[model samples]
Target chain A: MTLPRRGPWRIVFVAALVVAAVIFVIPFVWLVSASLREPGYVFSTGLLPLPFHPENYREAFQAVPLPLWLFNSAVVGTAAAVSVTLSSAWVAFGFAYFRFPGRDLLFGLVLATMMLPFAVTMIPTYLIWSELKLTDTQVPLWAGNLFGSAFYIFLLRQFLLSLPRELFEAARVDGASYPALFWRVAFPLIRPALLVVLVFEFKASWTDLVKPLIYLRDESLFTLPRGLKVVLDRFGVRRRAGLAHRARGQRHRHDPDDHRVLPRPAPLHRRHRDHGPQGLSRARSGPCGRRGRWPSGSPRPAPPWSSGSGP
Target chain B: MAAPRRRPTLARREARWGVLFLAPWLVGFLVFYAGPMVASLWLSFTDYDIVNPPRFVGLDNYRQMLADPMVARSLRNTVYYTVLHVPLTMAISLGLALLLNRVGRLSGFFRTVFYLPVMTPAVAVGILFLLLLNTQDGLVNGFLGWFGIDGPSWTTDPAWVMPGIVLMSLWSLGSTVVIYLAALQNVPRELHEAATVDGAGSWQRFRSVTLPMISGALFFTLIVNTIAALQMFTEVYTMFFGNQSTQQRFDADASTFYVIYLFQQAFQFLHMGFASALAWLLFLVILVITVVQLRLSKRWVYYESEES
Candidate 1:
């Protein structure tokens, strides 16, 4: 019974690996093939033998101002990542080093905050930004995440906790000040975790859609996901209208300028939503009345995400 | 070198410096995290449309949640995802980690290759899958055809949608494999050697020694994986709703994950109270599962301290 295994198990393991590779690769292969397939051929293309179309990417490019959106995403993602990392790491140092009153309680609350739904804060946070007059700017888009972000703080604290307390004791026995000790001792030890946090923050912020959508009303400020949304929504309406017009067959009878059927997205090619004066026509940035506030000004009276009476 | 601080002022200054170090995190938690959490609990008791002022509604949100059919469906979907994904991840990661533990070549490179998926932006992954799983031009069905087994339209069919989510999850099991590999390296060679002397095969040694030795790591992974699965938002958000075309989907109900459903109710429909209730219930579910796992782990998880 066992002799068979020496031969078959090796074959079996190889077969299993082959099966696993198929599982991982098949879906991804299909996606690249589909994304490259043109919209016209999209419906008709059979799976394996279909001709590869590089033009679908061109169509996708034509469909959206992907370059600008990509740029905006990079900026926003990087800003959030850097800000969150520095703040979180600095804050985590405090939690890790100090024996403060309410530290445990505060840490518990931070962990508990991880459970808080974004919806509960959505209105209040929006209202705060509105009140502060920062609604349309990239300032609001960057929306400096505080140092005490529970998740990152906890992560850094855990890393710090794993360090030998004797190291801290040894530093204190010497001439090192607390700040110098943290900077000199703790920071070096937790470099790995800090690097992880930066990557995590970048990925989280870059892929995020809802935050930018709420805070940044300016078309120039749209992140990749928001920019992507505008394209998808606009193109969808256009495709629908275009389809209808095609169905009607060259009817010059319809009002040519009527935009009710065709939805035009903000022209992504320009820094402004549209270079044509019609696009920049100032609109109320919604009920968020005081929308011009930036951090470059005095410390804003209200929290960035809260409409609560100013602190 | 220097001496200990001579003055009371210096000791006091050191204490103050420590406080200053912690102050940023402290202020952020109280203002952003704690404030919102308490606000959410309060909002759970009120009828909030977000735009309109919230009104006191007592337990109406919780009552409505009890009556909500979608809550049950979402809960079922979540439990199914957690149950299926956790064991599958464990099995796959362990298998891969074991295979690579004694590998002859490029161990570090293979480890990095596995972890690449975990680092990928989840939305990009979703988009990537969307392209691949396109019913018509998708590569999956093309391979299926080779096997003489036709796969269903993965995203289109309700039966296949959750499976798609699960498969997407399994592909990212590299993180778990890395952790498992780290644990595997520490398995006492003495135990494997002792078992080897007793005529034990690789399978027997793994069962009696490796499994028991790594039970703590297994426990930790289970709780973390459960929490990750329960809080799964980005994948479902991108896959089903966030990146959804405005076109009507095949099974509208099937597309929503439990967490995503809660997000929609609160954000899209402005049912903040109901959403809070859903969040609170999820918190309880996670807490209960965590407690149960911890209790069970006491029996099987051997602390190194115990043997010492």
Candidate 2:
């Protein structure tokens, strides 16, 4: 099964590796290039930054509460990671150390929960939070982790099982309390698994848009992903805003250097209050263009002066 | 019962301690999982708006689902996406793992390059792919144009939307690649050598020896990926429905997945009961699919323990 060390086979192998590497890396290059362009040139076909406008970063910062969102995301991610790690580890230790009545059945129940879709419990869970008067608060986002996620419990339990029973027994013989047995003996041994749980849960919390979309309505309370959703709503979807502004014969006020701009879409403050149930209906009739006029329906609008052609 | 009047046995004492340690999860199970599950099942039979008490509707919600066009469309869309996504992910990951397994010192670098996208937040990936999949000026289309292929309008076309999503999902197949790589490394070299001595060519060795050796990981990933693909939300939602303002502009019917429809029912339309029914339906689908997969695995998946 080993690749031939020398000849045309080695050359082909290297070429394949290089091609795969380029395919994987190019999207990131395109992302950085697009981010650097003047907002007008974002959709312009390019894989390289020729005329970079670093000011776009500054404008984006001023346009949105990016710092506040980052802070909120960090807090939520840390809380979720730390709580799930600690709680899942504790539960896993119990499963690993003790042979109790109905233990196998209980463990099976825990594993079965992994198969249950979150959609089933989502509505009831929301109702539970609303009943506790905690809806729209950050508590709903990370507080559930205190209960220990089933997946993490199962993962950490597997790690704990690999440890020799004699190590725990030795500690018990030395008059260690049960909690002390876990803390002093098993805890240190499973540090790597705990770390894995921490990282995974943190990523889960950080990337989570649905939970925040469901729970948080306040603008100031938004995590990074939720804030990004708002950003996409305003800027990402309607790339034609700049052209529409120029066609209307009004120069955007703030930047004399850039004529290809319009005033920021509806005030951020307006959206803050309008995120209620009524907002859902309002959004149905929002200012988005008609479906018939989608970019795909018409000929490719000649990339607003394409500098980088098909690269 | 009378025998229990004696001092607690060592085993009983240990069991008490075990229960004590398990208290947090026990409480969590009651509050978060068991309680909500029961409530969800009950709510599925009632008409519930958040403001008012639930009115028992006696299976009307389930009956509505039977006639709901959107429910059927969403399920079809999910199944289509699952069929496309799960196999592609598994195959590509296995391919990448095989490639990586052949490499020597540069393996870690390639592995990291592949896994990096998995670490990127799904929302970020969604946004990035939205830009990359843009019909006219997108990087993907641009790449295709280099090959003289006319790229379809990925996000806007109903026919191509699921394929677009499948492509985006493949970017995060790095996790699966890592899993497959682990499994591949665990395949005993002696088995391959033994096969080679028995007049097996490389392809024959791969088909006979490599496939079965890694079938457990393959089966595990198949089930996990199938379940995940069916439940897919964050990335699809971010790319397609993140903007409520422009949500209608896209091919809504085509891209509307089962979970998305469920979310709409529970949250947007306030059809909480209907949403619960939708959830239960999904649960049953998953249960049936998993059971079938396990059964089918008996024919193909070779376990060393079973062989012994």
* Tens digit of per-residue lDDT, candidate 2, span A1-311: 45424677656656677788778888888777767765566666666664566666666677679899999999999999999999999999999899988999999999888888999889889988988988879999999989888999999999999999999999988999999998988899999988988889999899998889988877799999888876766654234322111111122233332212223456666544323232233223453222211123221132221222111
DockQ of each: 0.18, 0.35
Interface RMSD, all models, one decimal each? 10.2, 8.8
Query: Candidate 1 regions off by >4 Å?
Result: A1-30, A37-52, A99-144, A155-193, A213-219, A226-311, B1-7, B242-247
Models 1 onward score TM values of 0.77, 0.88
Which predicted model would earn the best TM-score?
Answer: 2
Q: Scored by Cα lDDT, where does model 1 land?
A: 0.63
Report RMSD (Å) for each prediction in the order shown. Answer: 9.2, 8.7
Q: Comparing chain B with the reference, what is the TM-score for each candidate?
A: 0.93, 0.96
